[model samples]
Target: MTRRCIVLLSGGLDSMLAIRIMQEQGIEVEALNFKTIFTCCQDQSAQVARDLGVRLTVVGQEDDYLDLVEKPQFGRGKGANPCVDCRIYMFEKAKRFMEQIGADFIVSGEVAGQRPMSQKRRDLDRIAHHSDLDDLLLRPLSAKLMRPTLPEREGWVDREQLYDIEGRSRKRLIALAKKYGLKDIPTPSTGCSLTEPKFSKKVFDLMDAPGESRRWDYELLKVGRHFRFNSQTKVILGRDEAENDQLRYAHQLSDANSTASLFPENFLGPRAMLIGPRTDEAIEFAASLILRYSRDYDAGNALIRVDDEIINASETEQAKALQTIAAS
Candidate 1:
């Protein structure tokens, strides 16, 4: 009987190498890609799976994923990323996926000590033991340094064929990729927005707001000029045409309740969308941010609109009012 394994494919060098190693050892491999609203590399993962000729399974977090984001059991990383908790969630799901598909074990591209949050040796152990896949989970890229898993003990896989790569170095992984005849390699990145500091501020902002934040709000953080008006209010101004459309799209998200979306009604300025209470003060604030990005001071006054209704304000007045409003 051919042993089966599920590899967590993240469309990165390490993950591709992990799948390749499993295939070389004659283990049937399946690719699993887990997505969150904050994750931006799903397309890469899908394309990599297609290139590797493995059947791909895409899974998304439940609404409860928000619950974990709000408060993680292992706390958060540098940003809002609950790395340890998030890994536990993914691995726990992977465990169920293995049972459902009758796979003998699970594999990942994780290199010990490469990542600060969840790839530390201790963190890896906690993730495995807590997810209840202790001996059933394997990290082929670093398998030689760790204890052998059930698959190795049962002779379903050759322990000698696995690697023992460690730390944050990519030299070995790059070399292995070349050996495997892989090309067009992707640059190494955490592939998660949660790992970024600026992005995390917006995430933290959304989480701190009451009855206003949702997945939609979080997703829009990836595309805009984010400005925190207060703990309860924010205005995202689009920097260009692409962002302008995104701002429009964000306004239509399920949980968003902005009273009016502000746009450049008559000038060549940026389009700004408001999220939070749309009081007269908030609308004025949004207008002020819109003016800050405007080059239409020569137009004497710019006519801006909210919900298709126009408000004409002099460039100087708008700027002065916004500064006063922001300070108050």
Candidate 2:
């Protein structure tokens, strides 16, 4: 029987190259892409897999994924990204898939010292060990620089055919792509919002706030400007018409925590959602915000539909509450 491998294809040039290398050795390759709420590259992955003529399987993160984000065992990177822990999670799932499909080994494009968070030589070993792959896991792009894996030891894969590329430089990698005759080299992208500093600010905010953070709550973070009224109260205001439609739909989710929604009935303004109470205080705040963001509305002209009631946003409210946090 010919040896086979499952490669983690992130729709990037590195991963594409990894799969090509395996094919060069006559190893049957199946590609797997791990998906999370923060990941936004499914379409790209699908297209790349089709181009490579490899079957692709996309696995999603389970709710337990939230636990690591809240309190990572290995800690976080520059932002809220738990890179080490996240990779371990992905590999643990990949290992299950590998066994299910009887893949001889697992492959990734990670190079030593290429990523500060999880691609260090030591980190790679730890990830492999913890994910229970150990020598069964292979990094073809940097294989020669490291100890031989099971595939190499068992003569299943030729170590000499693998590479020794390391660090952040892409010069050698681009040359290798040319060697493989790969066109349409993909540009680098983290593809996960957790890696963005601004986006992570909102993530940290939700984690710190009172009450359980649900999927809907996290989804709203990607929508618009956010303001905190208190531990039990908050507001989200859309920045544009697209965001306005998104907020309107968010309020209707079965599990949405929104207490009320503010829609501009007679004037142009953003649609806003209230997270907690619908008290006069929250209503007044939400209304004032709609007006503040409205380009062509005044206090008297601003008519906001609040649940079943219509309220006039006063340019006259004593003072707007101090903004706890802005858009992230």
Model 2 lDDT tens row, 89-192: 99999999999998889999898999899999999999999999999999999999999999999998999999999999999999999999889998889899
What TM-score against the true fold does each predicted structure earn? 0.90, 0.95
User: Which candidate ranks first by lDDT, i.e. highest?
Assistant: 2
lDDT of 1 by residue, 1-328 (tens): 8999999988999999999999999999999999998887889998999888899998998877887888899988888889999989999999999999999899999999998889999999999999999999999999999999999999999999899899998999999999887896899987888888878877777777777455676677787787767767777888799999878876776666655788877778888887777777778778878888787444466778888688875665565545643210
Error of 1 at 56 (Å): 1.6
> lDDT per model, in order?
0.84, 0.89
* Candidate 2, run of 10 with poorest lDDT: 318-327
